[model samples]
Target: MQAEIGLIGLGTMGSNLALNIAEKGHDIAVFNRTTAKTGAFFEAAGALRSKIIPCTTLEEFVGAIRPPRPIILMINAGEPVDDQIEALKPLLSHDDILIDGGNANFHDTIRRNLLLDGTGLNFIGMGVSGGEVGARHGPSIMVGGAQASYKRVEQVLLDISAKYEGQACCAWLGENGAGHFVKTIHNGIEYADMQMIAEIYGIMRDGLGMQAKEMAPVFAGWNEGRLNSYLIEITAAVLDTEDAETGKPIVDIILDRAGQKGTGRWSAIEAQQLGIPATGIEAAVAARSLSARKDEREAAEKAYGALGETLKRDAGPLEDLELALLAGKIAAYAQGFAVMSGASGDYKWDLPLPEIARIWRAGCIIRSQFLSTIAEAFEGAEKESNLLLVPAFVEMMSEAQAGLRRVVARAATAGLPVPALSSALSYFDMYRQGRGTANLIQGQRDYFGAHSFERIDRPGAFHGPWAMNAG
Candidate 1:
């Protein structure tokens, strides 16, 4: 009963996280359904094994932790989480805290919290980002629960989180579902980011007639500037790597189809339901769906005739592609944050936008130099203003949007697919406009459905009596 924290599930993430905690000098109790896993972990733990108490059974695991315990669940999401909660609750006392560190749907977090209302068990829905290696080292941690409940394990979380400029990339974002909601939206932005990069790569491949080796240097160069990020760094490595057996770029050997595990789609669906226009994410998800329909694409290619090996190479003035990528990134972040802002207000979360930006500065898939700029913008702006309206970002958009316009136009004429970039450009354009063409939509709805439209000269809704006299 000397362990400070107890963890269940011995999956890759769970095992690595348990090792991290133990190496951090915290006495932790670990349990897996299979006893052999627990045995193997201790054998591999080396010097850190002394701090880890491996229990063969759940009951033994529960008894190993001290009072006012914090039990973390790093299992699969969906029904597994719900089922595990029911199984573990009987073993936990009223003062215990259960933390879900998996990528969960926020609504499910809210529902679970609601279900455990008076049970006296504290539920913390935490979003742990960065992949397997990050879990073993330090990942950005987003916590959503009561302040008191967060306080109980704050030090441990901070200690295990990645640091950016001497600050921990971890914080309590809000209460119930807020953390997972932020993570879902983060994945949404990640989708847009990856897709935009892939679209740019498509241009380099088809339009420029450049190989992966040629493009690797380009991505590497971008990493030295404002676009420097984990994704960019990794993209360079991935593209530059050659398949040893085939003697070709590894990327060329890989399948064109992209795989997704729901978070990106969920974010897009959530944004649509919330009536927040996250078009970049939406376009990215759609692009993935298009990629997945391989047979249909093959049939279409056969019917339409494939566009030969080399494009005419006339997508000129492409020196500003970096600027275009930057602009698209800004648009994606702007849309994502807007969705977050809407959710914050709708759910009364009062999420710390600046803090969110700060935490995202490191240890996350989207970590970048641009995040510091975002943090500064949020720190200086009125809470009601969008990122595009921030002074510095306004200047960025003013300078960069012209380049974005040029790139999108060139890609379009070159017959290159740039859906994410094109959609991002459109979103930015729509956001800054005072008047839009939706007035025609209003008129059409009124004419057909008698929905009525508001008049600029008058206060009330009005309908045209265009055919009354003739009828």
Candidate 2:
């Protein structure tokens, strides 16, 4: 019997995804550049091995799948992916679909889509989230390509995707690069969400004089409330763990610095290009960059004397911390969705905002009960309206903003760094202001360069009289 689908790159993600497809009753042919790994994977498959056709060569892998094939490339995102696509072009026949399943730069995805145009081979830039565990079981799949091409593989994708209340967390997002773009923004929100949580952790540790064991229950308790999510649940679990060798908290034994791939940075860049204020994501990216300069930070801390240690004080009630986190999260998600909205307009993709939120309600790292609220907000929202402006969110922000303000004020006084949270608060403040201070900036620009400014009283652009006095 012929295999239903073929997959390349039997790395961690690829191997797990292949198993998931097979477990869901689809025969999958899999290949790796190192032929030994393919055999090793098949050997490890055990009961599911019967459904896997291990292929030693690209030709064999392509041939194993039936005609008008659907092949998923789970390779690295850059040149390696391009190389694989080029190698497969000759081996693949007309109507064979190629799916790029990686954390790709959407721009690159668009280029590859255009490159494969009229080749009779369909190209899909698919975004797969939920890491190793999600791949082995189910993942949230974001597919982008021709509608017909997506329909060909839709059932298989649905079968392998996570279910939220029995509905699959997968959808054909748009054409060309939309899936990757949304995934990039997802990572951005993840960074912001994590950074805010870390800021709260910093407050608990430095200001409240709390240890990991003491903080564990706090986060665990928050998980049962509005902040209930996978990240919170795991945060509680991680804090409770101890290092076996040293008997110290496992988190204390771990390195302070964090590592990042390019997705968070990409999200910031794309937001700036589209003129959207994704300050929460930007602050998180900047914070990560600062964290990476560990040597410089250590030297500076020694020179200036450590402030985090000296600023120990009361951090207010735990309820305030929880509310602050929720508010910051709302701002971060709002900015992420705003960036997506801007990109949709720029690309003419006509992305379904509500559907995007609905699909993200499970499987992804940032999946949470909060997303259901976002989905509901988008359902009744005007096309160009911001999430902050949505009535439900306005009511939420009204109730929650006070807690955020108090948290920021306390963190500021205690000299604790709360970049993402503070940035979110600032974005919220600026966005809601009917008249901002930017008119002075416009006046400065006009005075120096004769650049025009628009009067609020009138529609057309006008120059400031300061240009007349410039020599």
Candidate 3:
């Protein structure tokens, strides 16, 4: 069947995604704030230009696409998404599909879905990942909206999405904002993983006194082991490169500071409001902030020279035990997913946690072998809520606990900060511990306010007489 897709932005990602769709035999109509951007796409696609019609106005763009028009918005995440939706509404008919393909805040998505309820326009909060190249080829897509609305456009999405074992990369995540919520947490986990990789790089470099070139082989070897992943594989490539002119290692020459676009921070903030522990994500954000303090760190390093000692290498090979590190990383990812699970429960989204893990096994940043285990954790559980308590994950945590302790202790002893990795282990420990010190504070609340508390000795009741009198 012929499908006509409208693209409202021709930025790097939009342009590439449009091309990918066109290449897949679907016709695409392009529109942009700047007409020139759309023109460039038309010129670049050449003969494929026949598949893409550039429109000067949103009205013309909407008019050009087929009925029940599926328009994908690839604009900036926040206010810009709002602006585009407002501009497109008057031009769109009821029951038309509006897909937000940007990194929009999930809360805003929830509000927008409600706002468009009476308009008959279907709004889908879609999380598209894999970046520009992924767009040009295939990316992992997370969609959240009415199931019927998702079914309406699933074919088009499937054609453009990266396939994994014959399943479409696209899945109906849940209702309303669920898609973007998963994406937000996906990005949060991404931040943690990237920071952890950087920490490992730092440990190998500063702590081990290994050059970037020297480190490439180690990473490459690790990639062949249980720690194998796209990130580790790419890290090997990153370590191998050197500046042609300066003959200095590329990684060493690059700036120490890292930049963030705010999604990770937003995830942490949401976790706090929801009373969920997102320690891995929080550490990732902290790692970025620490990166921004390069000058202060350099100064301190100079002032405290010789006081710091280098890391001592482990006596023997850890080849057989690399699964320990892998297991800890899996627990970190599980904790991140647990945060999303909590948010979904609170929002009444009914998200499919198992499918989320399955879709994430490819295209996305956290795509790793461990995700299969996470998917199994959800599937084997009696209820979806039991994912964290699954036997496999619990066993993985148990196996990794000692290695995590050793890694954290070694990093501390060597004066190296492994914030993301360390915090991930801490989160795993805390989750398994089940009981928290915060209950002491809750006890104090009952003591002072006469608030009801569940009696450890018996059951639930109002504890203090003074609290009952105050009430």
lDDT of all the models against the reference? Answer: 0.89, 0.91, 0.80
What's model 1's lDDT at 422? 99
Give TM per candidate: 0.96, 0.98, 0.91
**What stretches of model 3 exceed 4 Å from their correct place?**
1-3, 302-307, 314-324, 381-388, 434-454, 461-471
| Tens-place lDDT digits, model 2, residues 1-471 | 789999999999999999999999999999999999999999999999999999999888999999899999999999999999989999999999999999999999999999999999999999998999889888888888888999999999999999999999999999999999999999999999999999999888887888999999999998998889988999999999999999999999898899999999999999999999999999999999999999999998899877653333544457789889999998999999999999999998988888889888888899988788788777763643788887777888898999999889988987889999999999999998999999999999888988889998879989976677887
- Any idea what lDDT model 2 has? 0.91
* lDDT (10s digit) by residue, model 3, range 269-296: 8889888787878998998988899889
By lDDT, the better pick of 1 and 2 is 2
RMSD of each: 1.8, 1.4, 3.1
Off by more than 4 A, model 2:
308-315, 381-384
Question: Which pairs of residues have clashing backbones in candidate 3?
Answer: 95-120, 450-467
Local error of candidate 1 at residue 52 (angstroms): 1.0
- Superposition TM-score, candidate 3 onto the true structure: 0.91
- Taking all chains together, the TM-score of candidate 1 against the true structure is 0.96
Best by lDDT: 2
Candidate 1 per-residue C-alpha lDDT over 1-471 given as tens digits, one digit per residue, 9 for 90 to 100: 389998888899999889888878899999888899889988999999889999998888889999898998998999999998898889989879999999899999999889888999989999998888778888999999888999999988998888998999999999999999999999999999999999888978887788999889989998998789999899999999999999999999999999998899999999998899999999999999999999999999899887654444543444577889889999999999999988899999998888999999888999988788888887773643678888778888888898889878878877788999999899998888899889888887777777889887779988877525323
* Best of the two (1, 2) by TM-score: 2
Ranking of models by lDDT: 2, 1, 3
